[model samples]
Target: MSEKTILVWFRNDLRIHDNEILLEAARKADKILPVYCFDPYYFKIAADGTPKTGALRARFLLESVADLRKNLQALGGELIIRIGNPAEVLPQLAEQYTVNEVYHHREVAYEETAISEEVETALWNLRLNLKHFIGHTLYHKEDLPFPIKDIPDSFAIFKKKVERDSNVRPCIGTPESIITPVITDAGELPTLTQLGLDEPVDDPRTRIKFKGGETEGLLRLEEYFANNNQIAPTKGRNGATVDRSSKLSPWLALGCISMRQVYWAVVKHEQANNVHNTGMLELELLWRDYFRFMFKKHGKQYFAADEQTENTSAEKQTLFEKWKTGNTGIPFIDASMHKLNATGYISNFSRQMVAGYLVRDLEVDWKKGAAYFEEKLIDYSPASNWGNWAFVAGLGHDPRDNKYFNLAKQASELDTNSEFISTWLPVEVAV
Candidate 1:
């Protein structure tokens, strides 16, 4: 019998290191083919007719895929690119290659779950086995103490339980070697112009500066930790630069980098430098895991405005619009929205504040706000985006509804000199 070929379908998990699916495929198969699909459906307009993946996100995705292609090639594997529905395209590829099995990282979001199901069904028809590995979160889904059905209703309870008991598994390294296959024919990657997006022009004013890819992501992790010593800050008022934060979210969001790799790097940094802190960085990573666990428990309902109950009100819609267009009449909230719209990025603090303004003060549907973030944010992840929105809307794990920031209070606190607000919202506020 000829060597069995296993197809490793790259979705959100783009990096080679710490990728369980890729490593498992290499271990089990004589030959492995790496594949990535640029689903046109992602770029389609929603019912509201807005572009689903806006320019910033599309551009970042393009960069990430390009980087992944390079990384895979270095590992003696070709990154196959396809444009279409994966359910249709993947099965066809499997049939062509006589693939015995397909492996991929599991995704828990509604659309992702739907696609995974569809693709699995299609592959089953061809007698090819489908294998999925948990890789997006720091904590693997299967290792959790409680099953999906038993996931806690409150985040604090969930976090405390996991931190005390759950172990974050070590990172999975790449295979020592794999036989390079002969399949070289692959489709072209979509250009910004092809995707109906203008080339991204660099902005001189923006503070956040980086591009997509695992290499850049790793490099950033090194620089931020080494140069900044951000972990030393005890309070939020330490005057640390924005880069003090991990800056790994964008890469992690796209799966160009794995959370396991990030966790290990932070551990190594602390060990080497003898630096210690209140585990703020670890807490942030836990937040990421918490979102994934929440999605696992709630499924599609997590995307809904009321996962626990159904109580839609008219006032929520009104507030959602104000939040979307950055015209909420609150200077700080408006500035954060404008920054997100322009650059596809925002600080974590700003994200919470703006989300709160829409869900609590403006009384808008959380779905609309989450969808808008999905369209605009370069670092958008279905779990984090929807989970945070639900928290703000008082529909997720939060014990109580949080209040939106008072514009003057936040402006004075976060942007003491009004620098961040003025930079994004250059126009003077109306009296």
Candidate 2:
């Protein structure tokens, strides 16, 4: 009889290093097969009737998967690409290959949970064990100070407690060696056209100058830290930008890169440079972990508006059109919104301000704003996007729920000289 094979199902957690699921599969099975499914449901029309994964995100995902396939091939394994539902597809593949176990990263959002449950049921019927591990976050879910149920409602409290008590474990390295399997064959990756998306032309004026993949992600980490020597501080909310901030979220969100590899890279850089700017980069990673933990705690309630508010349903989707089109009449917000519209990416500061305008000034529901972000951002993570949106809407972790920014005020403050605003916001304002 042949050795039982372990199938690694790739979702948002794309990389191989520090991946608990991948590591476990390597230990228990003689041969490992990695699979990523481009589920049609993800590309389906959203509630607003816009394609959930727009052209820009679809293009990035296609490139990211192509890169992953190359990486897996280099490691003596192959990344199998499939379409259709995971619940149906995984079982069929398992039966064909006689796979004994399946491994994957855990997801907490509503749609993801539904798909995961369906996949689990299918696996159970086939007598295959479905194993899941926490891999997307910097801090492991099991190591958190509080249990999921006990997680605090407020982010600051959670951040403070985690900062005081929790520690980020070092990243796990890749398998010493991987064994190639020849039992099954998979098809080539579908192009954007195959995925029902037109090829997106890259905008020349985009601020984000990176591509998708573990190789490119690591190269960026090396390049960014090599040139600048500043470190970010944890406390004081000083709002200082650091050259040390790893712009790995886009790849990390898509699972094209691993958080452990990022952590390891940061540790090596700190040691080599012998500089601790203020543990700011590490602190940001901790915040990333905190948002995931929050999602684990709140579940779908994170997507709803507070029922106790009298004006809940009265909130109209007024500012969304302007915000989405980047013509909110406010220069900074307009610029950021326009930038995101054209390039499918925006800086973190701009993200918060534009989100603030929609939720606070325009009085739109945060979910609508979040859904729009979901449609546009290349780095869109349910945990981070919704978590941050809820925080800005005064619904998630902020103590002061009334966080609104006067667009003009923000324009003067962040772009006092008006250079940042003028770059995106045109001199001739649309009437």
Candidate 3:
């Protein structure tokens, strides 16, 4: 019998390390063909009237795809690139390449899940197997202590149960070399214009300068923790430079590196250096895992808003425009929005505050704010992003008092020297 050919569809899990789908495919197939699609659906204008995949993220994605191709090539394989719907392009590739099987890391978010479902059905119709693996979360779904539906709605409960019950799986091995598959063009990485995005302009004030891909992500992990001795602070929620940031989320967002790889890296650091504060960072990862499970448990309901939240800011368009532009007249919320627009990211505290401002202060629907962030954040994850917004909107995992911060108090503490605010403030705000 001739050698079996397998097609590995690259989605969020872009890295070669601890990649269950990639490793499993390498073990079975004679030739492994890796492919990534710059899906048009993701780039289209969002409900908030901005491209869901904006320039910063589009550029980061482009960089990541380029890096992924380079990494795969270094391992003696080529990453086939495509532009279009995965549901269509992936199946066409399976037919064109005579693929015996298709393997991919599964996604839990509704839109992502829907796309994967369609691709699975399409591949099945072609008489090829579409295999899905769990790589997005820290813990594999099968290994979870409880069924996804039975996952506790409250994060505190879920976190305690998981920490006691589950183990963080070790990184999987990468194949040194794989048999070559005959595919036509490797396909060019599309330019920003091709994706209907402008070239991203550099901004000096932004906290995140993260490049995409596993190499950069791992390098960042080391530099942030080991070199800088930068453990995550107790999230002071005061937007000081160090108080507010770590650029890890962007890499995690892209699946450029798996949560397991990141978790292990921290473990190695703590063991080598005898650090204790790494616990908080590890907890953050657990929360990332919790959101994924939440997405799995609730599906579309996770994105819904509670009916009680209202639009206090007159018209929907008027209030949203101010919120989006960071002209909300609340200096703290405005500053956070300004940083987000300029840098494509904000610290977790800022995310909570701004999201709360939109819901509680402006009385705008939390979904509107969530939709806006989805279009903008360099590290946007549907589960975490929507889950967080809903949590603030009193619609997610916890049913606590709706979170709201004193804008003046936060501004006073976060920008005491007037340095951050004055530096990044727009001309209008500054004047």
lDDT of all predictions: 0.77, 0.73, 0.80
Can you rank all candidates by TM-score, best first?
A: 3, 1, 2
Ranking by lDDT: 3, 1, 2
lDDT of 3 by residue, 57-99 (tens): 8888888989989888888889999999998998888878888
lDDT of 2: 0.73
Candidate 1 root-mean-square deviation in Å:
4.5
Clashes of each: 2, 2, 2
Quote the lDDT for 239 in model 1: 45
lDDT of 1 by residue, 1-431 (tens): 78979999999987888888888888888998888998877888887678889988998888889998888888777788988899999998887877889998888888899899999999999888889878899888778888888988666777888878788899888876655467758768889778766665544467777688888888877776776555554334434223256667899898887888888887887798787652767777888888888888878766455644423555655566667777777876877777787678887778888877676776565677788999989998988888887776667656362322222233435543334444344333346
| Angstrom error at residue 120, model 3 | 1.3
State which candidate has the highest lDDT.
3
Candidate 2: which stretches are off by over 4 Å? 229-245, 303-305, 308-318, 397-410, 416-431
Q: In model 1, which range of ten residues has the least summed lDDT?
A: 401-410
- Give per-residue CA lDDT, model 2, range 1-431, as digits (tens): 77979899989876666677777888889988788999998888866678888788877777788887887777778888898899999999888777888998889877898899999999999888888777777767787788889987765677788768877788776877667478456778888777777666665565466677777777776675775643442321223222234566788788766766667677787788787653656666766777787778778776455663434442254456667776677776776776776678876667878887887888776777788888788888888888888777777655363222222333334542223444453234335
